[model samples]
Target: MTTNQAVSVAVADRRPLPHLLVFPFPAQGHLLPLLHLSTHLATRFAFSITVIITPKNLPLIQPFLSSSSQIHPLVLPLPPSSSLPSGAEHIRTLPDGTPSAALIHALSSLRPSILRWAKSQSNPPSALISDFFLGWCVNLAADLQISHVSFFSVSALLAAILHPLFLSLPPPSSTPVSVSPSLPSFPFPHLPSVFRRYVAGNPDWDFTRESFLSNSLSSAAIFDTFDFFDSHYLSHLRSSSYASGRLFAVGPIPPAVPESDNSNIFPYLDSCPPNSVVYICFGSQFTTEPALAAAISAGLESSGVRFVWAVGTAAPEEFNGKGKVVKGWVPQRAVLEHVAVAAFVTHCGWNSVLEGLVAGVLLLAWPMEADQFVNAKLLVEDAGVAVRICEGGPGKVPEAAELGRLIGEAVEEGSWPALRLKAAEMARKAKEAVAEGGSSFLAMEEMVKLLKQATTED
Candidate 1:
């Protein structure tokens, strides 16, 4: 080849990699999926990633950063605000009854610093991808003249229910409308129930709604859900006016948990019989109240089932001989994937639900707040992969006897053989979707292509 042609070829081959700035909502659930996405972008798409996090969540994400040279962690200062406690930068660290507005304001206050940092970057980020809660980033992306992508770490089912189509539905007679078993899917029943019971009472509900609306104005959205499970809801969102931009279902987004990292978390699992223990945990943000915790403790003991419970705080003395209590952060994905774990007693957080589904464990759905209740309904009533523990609203704590009965029923083959079979099938599909050339895999590729095209056009 001629010298001029060789020089041109080298220049074309050495094209600069796209830089993406990712900002998660600063909670464990939010941080995890985005972190996984960052890793995927780095390894799969060869993009440069800078994940922005606050001081408090730095520890949780530090290990991931240390492991990856391609992905960088940028720690931003938690803005000083009287609404939050001193050093309270994370949602999990914030005291109970703290207003959601306070957290939103605190997060919003960081915008100037974020913009300043962006301006100081040697090669400005080609795009800004943020958790849907950080709606301010959408505007910032516009100001920076780069592409914006909103990441919703939620199910498409939950998304459809929360969409304007359902939100605009007429109210039921009851103040907090109860979800009847016979409620039809068309026209979206039980939405008022969701609003009155979960959204209306939540201090930050309005803030969350506004954030979602703002995020809809972005270039596109990414959901941590798979096609087979969420195709119906995905179609609904695409047809509806709520989703303005392209919607991508590129998930069952499992975090990369190294086997060496959490080996010590569940040493007792070695002794337990295969698929014999029920693993229980709420997400990072939802602390099980004392009354419910006592009920669950009593229930687990009475059922005579081998169990591993991650209660966040110390387990009660009652559990000392009967079962294991994981006080600190256990490697949840690791625990779920363990051979000794038969079932998952969960709070129905999307991440936890996806993890349980991926692990092929039957769920004992005990929804705490927000979309969790809706998620539980989908799992139990619609999907048939799970059974509900608490039938009433969030206020109704499961009694010890009821909890025991449910626990026993979950493990009993005679009672739920069909359900168990279906759960196994769902797990298989979840795995397939994320496999090479699978539905989620293709969707992820499409998303990356769109991002690259947008960056090039900009």
Candidate 2:
């Protein structure tokens, strides 16, 4: 038998394998990557996996559950809260696409429910792998006497940047703080919009800030970032948090695309020249303000580059030969992989960054909130694969002339080829990091060993 199979068989031989319980904060960017990672652990290690999901998010987990019986769902009804809009279990489904603060407040209510369920169980899970946003899971797992492995949906770079902030009392002020000698200090205002909004004495705000701080005390931490893309940051985080000594960098876990999928699937990409089309998408949670949207459309139109704009709303006037403007979703992974796609204009969300990196598509970054500004720094300054075209929220608009120039110049012959080449090199290392015997692969194996050890002691 092959090595992975042999490992799986040996793991399965230990009947009633150590159960892994997962809890994802309800957001598209956070949910999907953890699900993908959970599925990988199940298939490769033959471990039983149970996901803690709300009634509304159940549908999203169905396909992953259907394919693998090893993975199961533990549905928990979302307790009613005025803070959350009814039936809105995910940030993507929030009315008018609001950011996740309200949703985070609503999710904090589930802590008691989760605690009760675990306490009643005959076999409490060996480990509770939960989203970084739900840092209270560290305390929850402690209550159940299980390992709480904090799972960061953000880049390792962002997590490293947040470490100092988490330890600081009363959160960060307007001043900048140094995280690593290799990287620039981050001003508090640019850290995360939510952090600046914290009011120390308020219960909800204190709870939220406490949740962010609890990650440091986790039994272990895992980032959905592979070493190739965030090696320096990951190493810095490890050295800083060495007392925990169990940080894992095991991802950018390949997307769930079918292996047999083909380029002929997209006629526009199929027909376009190599390194020709520009791909534009901000994440689902972000909606461009109409004026900003109009400016972007005008810029794309003026640039004269072949492009694909998944604007979601406020579409540009289509010039038939120029490009296609989409109102909804596009298969991002497939689009990035296409030979015709030269560059991506993106929000620098961790998931989108990995997609662009793995495809070797250079970035034209428009980072808004959360850890995006820091992620933009990694791409623009540290890695040299992206150019920062714009920064700040939807209201922050740039001159159409400047925006068009940056977009046009991203693929222009000057420095574009070098950026693309470096991206390609990172992409190669990224794929290798997840393959057998790679840095990510070994880290995962070590995590599994720790998980199995947890159960044996039980």
Candidate 3:
């Protein structure tokens, strides 16, 4: 048997495993990271894992399923119709065609279903891991007397910044702002521009109430970031009020661990000479307009960059001649690790950024919403790993010239190779964190122990 197999068998033969119920926030970005973490926990700890997902997202969650019966997929039913806003189905489209407020509410509204699922499980979970934003899970854990911890499905840097804000946003005033349709800008300036836009439009005026909800609700906060990437952020978290000795940092959870080789899938994938292809993909959630997609396609063609763009809803048909579009999903980790993938053009999702860094690939940041813009900023400003597309006319799509010039400059820039080398170094540190004596492994051990103690006290 292979060394990994031997280790797996030994782990299985050990004492009874813990039962873990992992509930991710009901979105693609949230689901994928939590799934990766759940898979790791199941394989390494021999734990029985139940992943809670919304019914709408079950199809996307299904393909990742393993043959191992130890892992279970549980779908939380949609809530009562009355709880939903009017024309909720159409809410995927805002009045001006952006993502709608109703969609956000619908995602957050899954608390009742998740709580019911947890309480109703036949084999009660030994521990609970939930998304940090899902504050209601803490309440459910308390009500059910189950040990619970929050999962921040992003980087150590992002989570560290967010943790303090969770506490910081709570108001100091006598009167509270009402949660309403009109969202106001976030209290903090550090939030990404897109998040700023959303908050500006959709006021949770309920910030103080939500902050209290979080403090009272979660037993601990867990981050999906490794220790090496952002020591300062992690340290900040440990010392803050958001600090619960309950925080856990366990990650570098690439889509595939040890990478099961699939050379036949993309035969050209390995054959391409080293550092030739620019790997382009926004995370799974981003869906853009035909105009933007076409513009990006024209740019890739103009740049003469051999690329594999993992086509999602945002990928346009116009690029058929310019590059290969692997519809559905592509093994991102494998692509990044492939020698030919010299650079990554991305939406700057935390997981994507981490994986690219882990693979030591240079980056092209095209942030959409949420913390992505800030992540792009950090990569360019803090990490020195990427460059942004140049701004264009107000409504004009990126011209072939703009795309060509940036890609050419980035490729020829002597700094890119240096940055790639640095990114690889970061990746090495990430791997070290999960090694047997690594910081992430030890953190998990400590977290598991804390959960056992907390549950016992409860």
Candidate 4:
């Protein structure tokens, strides 16, 4: 062959590697799953990855990305706003009583800077993957002529319940609507309460509504739930034309750290009996009220169970002797996997729920905000892997006796053997879904294929 012919052949074989830009909401629950997804894509498919995070949250996730050369972190500055305290870019850092309007404004201010950075990339990202709330990124991607995918850190069941198709239901005029009696087949019985609280009068209702609606227009929607756990909701989403046939279940994605690396993070686990200790945590964004925290502490003390509780801003002094009280960040995934951890007392945040399920630990659900109530219902009422501590609604706190009784019952050997068995089974399924040739693994493969195809077409 001539020199020109050889040069042409070389050029055809040297296709540029596709780069994906991931932007997660600046909260622990949202950031972890999207980070894991980015790591998985880079490790499994050799895709170039760029993760955009605010300056405040950079330190927390920087350690996780240090070893991965394939993934790069980009820091975006939060715009100047009097509404947010100085240096408080992350949702977790905002004051406990910060108005939702101010928080939403702070988040929305991120758009211009993100768009500017996207345009400045040396090799422009082939696609954009962002948290569902950052729906503006979808429009940004369209303008950049790249594909956009929305990542829902919540469960698929919650996504289905919040979809536009369901929100169109007529509201009751006088009384709060009881969806269970009207729609018996509905998967989430707790949604009516969520509707009454969030959709009706919450300050962030507009933001939530816009995010879910915008998600339908994305190239694909990704969920952090395994198929075995949410197959019914996934199937319903796929069959519905409103979902755009781009729904993908690619998770139950745990942190990407090695087992050995995480083992020593919590040394206290070694002293407790195997499957005897209860692990308690509310996700980063939720703060426990003083009264409720005291009640929970009293209950745990009375229950006679060994526990490690990670309460974000709640004073550790309150529960110093009753049980371990961890303030600030803890290695949650590491703690959950410890052999001594028998059950979880959680706020029912989807990430915590997924981690608990993956570890085969039974759950004592204490949902606090947003989709947590719906998630609690799914776990306790539908899946049988958890027991509800009390009726969940905004500002509803259980008595210490009730909390203690539930904790005691959840840990009793003879009280709910079937629930324990079911939890173990679900954990097995979660593991299977992410293994080679499993549903979640294949979903990742399919996503990479689609990304490559989009790049080729471009």
Candidate 5:
């Protein structure tokens, strides 16, 4: 070959693999999904991923680190500040009733540290991919001259519903927004608690609101959802002026957790009959109020349904000898995958909701805060796989007797057969998405292709 040919080969071989600097908001619900995405970007598409974290969150990413070589950690200590308790690196560790805005405000201090780290690197990241909670990263990406993308841990249905608000439009009118003729629209009164609590010009409310609004200006946004849930919602957002043809739905990805020695727990799980167990958990952050826990136990006992409750705080002592009450870690995905678990009592956090969907278990949704309220709506009205028990947010305890009647009816043999079919069908659709030539598989390809393209053009 001529010298010119050799030079061409040398230059082409030196081209860098597209690198993404990912920042996961420090909550299990927020962090785990991004870790799954980071692993997907690395293993599935061969992109180099550098995830940002404070010191305490390293353990959370440990499972992913041991599995993939392409993803690296950029740990920066929080600069000394009295705003948050020391060693409170993630939201799950934050004291209950701490203002939601406090952590967001505290985290913004890391912007300078991240900026310095990126500058010191030899090959700058191709783009910055951050959780929607850290919407301010759009500016950080601008400073580094990299494309900015926000990853939403919520559903596309919620994203489309909130698009107007994200663009600074008026609150959705009390009339239900017509999402689809066949499915129920989340009327203004039924909208998420976060949106309902909006107080214009209030300092704390404005701060949180702007964090959400800043995401609309991102060059691109990713949703942890798939077309099977709502193609119309996905299409609407893609066509919206804010998204401008840059929205990717590559999800229903399962959370990563440690391997099971759940054999100890399975004796209880094993003793239950097929589709006879009700599995209850309220996500990572929300501690169950003691009275509410007792009320739930009362209801479960009244129904005479065998159950497994993963109450993070304290389990009700009254239900002793009747059910399994776990006060510590339970392998949620593993437990849900079991045949005995027929229904899930959940907070409807997107991650937990997706896990239940994939397991083909019915969701007994009790949305407390954040996007959970909207999630419950989509499951009950749109997806037809869930039944909402009560949703007044946290501290709105329901009457135990009424809750029991609902739970018993929901899981009774041969009840809601059509709903059960939908749940099972959703599970199959989830599997199909990962199969070759599926919608999500194709979307994943396009997302990676575009990310690489953006890197080259920049």
Candidate 6:
């Protein structure tokens, strides 16, 4: 038997075999989690895997593929891009971008081509795994007679939060928004208007309309998160979906643990002269108010701590200077792992939180949109590793003093030997959650079985 077969046989002795094709939502935030999950499955289950990246992400993914020679063989074909719309090109900041309607049309046009490519493969992927944002994958799988599974790349807690919101959406509203303005805001005050629209609009309907084609198709759903962080909510999804047996929790799909001395992952740790630097980053989807962004810069400068800031196009001029804003896609994983990063001033994205906790860094939580406020609550109130900042309004920005104080407090708290010890302990737990026989690893096994059954049974 081939080496791949040998590995598959060993893994499938307790279940069945599946070949997985993973397609992520076309953005960096969506792609990273799905790619991590793909990497994990290929290693643990010896599954034949194909990771589909838009031309834009080719560079980022290329490094990982090159870094590990073993993962090279499982790489399968990329779908032909010709049939997709010009607008479908995964360009950064596309001008005059089409709305969901046009995006849906473009995906529909590309569907037939994706199917033809699937058929052309030597061993067709047994199961198709894609981001819930792409909704068209459900129909494409139907056309190809393959099992399609939707994977949410956010935290299970976020998924659970969205799930109830999805269920509450009224049927076929004209604008997809049924909620009133007076609805109590989530405790996290800094949510942006764009994301507020997302929550206000029935995301369930959004999922159905944009991703699942109004729920006409039956596709299994999976989440990319671990039970340790969100066991209660994940358990709820599991119990609810037990009858359908269509949901799986397989996540915390970070890079594989190193042989020993994982300290290398946090390169900046040694450079710190005890609580010296503040790290700033907002989620990709969040828009930075130029005023607030400048105020934050002044705050950091005034506080007199070295800072590493990650900002996008919306960053103000004042923040762009010596030892301040790194601006434009800083190596987030690497920076968080740095020892100099005393505190994380973050938008409280789930991935960022996971990485910070892994690096034993304390947090200044600044959630903007969706369940981020809720996540901040869990961290600040439950975990005691972070502090939550209050917002001015729906789209209002905070003053420099507010941001500075939060950063200073986080750095101070993180510098305490006891707090650092606690962070280290949390880091250890995070590592265990992904190790062999850990919750995430076992969840992956269960998900693989579900995929294989879905593939073969059909």
Name the lDDT value of residue 247 in candidate 5.
84
Clashing pairs in 2: none
Candidate 6 Cα outliers beyond 4 Å, as residue runs:
1-18, 53-57, 64-88, 96-105, 170-219, 242-247, 256-271, 285-287, 313-322, 390-395, 413-425, 453-458
lDDT of 2 at 227: 78
For residue 110, model 4's alpha carbon misses the true position, in angstroms, by 4.2
Candidate 3 weakest lDDT stretch, 10 residues: 178-187
List candidate 5 stretches off by more than 4 Å: 1-15, 166-190, 196-205, 255-263, 317-320
Please write out the lDDT profile of model 1 over residues 1-458, one tens digit for every residue: 64344435545898556788898887777878888888878766767788888877788777668655667877888877877888887777778767555676578777788789889988678889998767767888888888888898987766655545334534544444422222324222334233433354444556555665576577888999988877766776676644474888888985654523443546788888787788888877666767777778889888888887887665674454657776766778878888888899988988888989998888888776766776787788777899877743445677788788788776666667877888899999999999998999998989999877866876
**Winner by TM-score between candidate 3 and candidate 1:** 1
Q: In terms of lDDT, which candidate is strongest? A: 2
Residue-level lDDT of model 5, residues 96-184, one tens digit each, is 65555667767778888888988898878988999988888888888989989989888877776665554454555857655444344
Better of 2 and 5 by lDDT: 2
Q: Give the TM-score of candidate 5.
A: 0.88
**Which pairs of residues clash in candidate 3, taking residues 3 or more apart in a chain or in different chains?**
182-203, 183-201, 183-202, 183-203, 184-199, 184-200
Per-residue lDDT tens digits for candidate 2, residues 111-174, read: 7887887777766688899999888788888877888898888877777766565556445656
Those runs of model 4 whose alpha carbons end farther than 4 Å from true positions after fitting are 1-15, 81-86, 96-105, 108-112, 165-208, 258-265, 313-322, 391-395
Q: Give the TM-score of candidate 3.
A: 0.78
lDDT of each: 0.74, 0.79, 0.63, 0.74, 0.79, 0.60
Candidate 4, backbone clash total: 0
Candidate 3 per-residue C-alpha lDDT over 201-266 given as tens digits, one digit per residue, 9 for 90 to 100:
243324323532463346677776777766655666566545365567777664533434433336
Q: Model 1: number of clashes?
A: 0
Model 1, global lDDT: 0.74
lDDT of 5 at 102: 62
The per-candidate count of clashes, in order, stands at: 0, 0, 6, 0, 0, 6
TM-score versus the correct structure, for each prediction: 0.87, 0.91, 0.78, 0.85, 0.88, 0.76
What CA RMSD would you report for each candidate?
4.9, 3.1, 6.3, 5.2, 4.6, 6.3
> Where does the lowest 10-residue lDDT sum fall in candidate 5?
2-11
